[model samples]
Target: MRRLSGVTIDCAEPAVLAGFWSALLDRPVSAEHARPDWATVGSRFDPAPRLTFQRVPEPKRGKVRLHLDVEVDDIDEARARIEELGGRWTGERHDYPGEGVVLGMTDPEGHEFCVVQYF
Candidate 1:
């Protein structure tokens, strides 16, 4: 059997980025792994794969080829909270009428992700 371990995000400040994700996901940043150059959310014991942030030398240059999709019960509320946590709404929204809504968003450092609300 095979399983996924974690997703590593490259950034300039691991701790700060980790903090943002921790707040957004309502998961505690692992105290054991928190550091200037690296930080993580979730642990081996958690069912979900960990979210790891690592310091990188270069700034992000272009649109991310892949991104996270965060599911929420209410997209508007989620958007407000995400902004409070230092994330930004990209002004790109998609609505599927009877299905759901998807909003483009970016983390504090501009890494893209999506906030989704399903009917």
Candidate 2:
């Protein structure tokens, strides 16, 4: 059986970004890890997946080949929260009409991702 383990993001400061995501998801940082170069946040109660932040030397450029889609109850509220967490709202794409709404955004390190709301 195939199972998803974790998603890792490359950033200059692993702990900082990890903390931001931890607050966004309301998950506690993993106690098993003791490395400054990497940080993870998640737990068995939620049981979704761990978000791992890794240290990288260079900054990201152009478009990201892979990104995440976060589901939210309110798109506007989610966008506001992302901004308050040091993320920037790039733009919104409404191609699917009534199917869903997607807002393109980048983290502090410029890694592009999308916030999607489906009804």
Candidate 3:
């Protein structure tokens, strides 16, 4: 069986990025890492997926090949909260009516992620 372990994001400041993601996910930062160059955040439950932030010297230049898909109870409310947390809403797709909605957003560092809602 295959299971997701964690996802790493490149940033100039690992602690700062990790704080943002930790707040968004409502989880605590990892205790394993005690360095400013690298930080991880996730829950203590089963199948916990860590969001690792690593320090990089240069800024992101191209499009990201991978992005996160977060499940939210309400799409509109989640989008608003994300925006307040330094996330920018890119767009939304409404293909399946009353089923689900996908809102594209970017992090403070311009990493694209999606917020999905299912009814």
Residue-level lDDT of model 2, residues 1-119, one tens digit each, is 55676788988998888777887777888854568798888843445878888898987767878998888888899889989999889875664777888889777777778888897
Instruction: Tell me the lDDT of model 1 at 88.
Output: 98
- Please write out the lDDT profile of model 1 over residues 5-116, one tens digit for every residue: 6899999989889889999999989965656788998885788888999998999999989999999999999999999999999999999999999999999999999999
Candidate 1: give the clashing pairs.
none
**Runs with alpha carbons beyond 4 Å of true place in candidate 1:** 32-35
- Give candidate 2's TM-score: 0.88
Ranking by lDDT: 1, 3, 2
Per-structure clash totals for the candidates: 0, 0, 0
Evaluate residue 103 in candidate 3 and report its C-alpha lDDT on the 0 to 100 scale: 86
**Candidate 3 structure quality by residue, lDDT tens digits, 1-119:** 56777777999878877877888889888865677699989743437777888898999988899899999999889888888888899875654787888888888888889999998
Error of 1 at 92 (Å): 0.4
TM-score of each: 0.94, 0.88, 0.88
The C-alpha lDDT values of all candidates are 0.92, 0.80, 0.83
TM-score of 3: 0.88
Q: After superposition, how far is residue 55 of candidate 2 from its true place, in Å?
A: 0.6
Report model 1's TM-score to 2 decimal places: 0.94
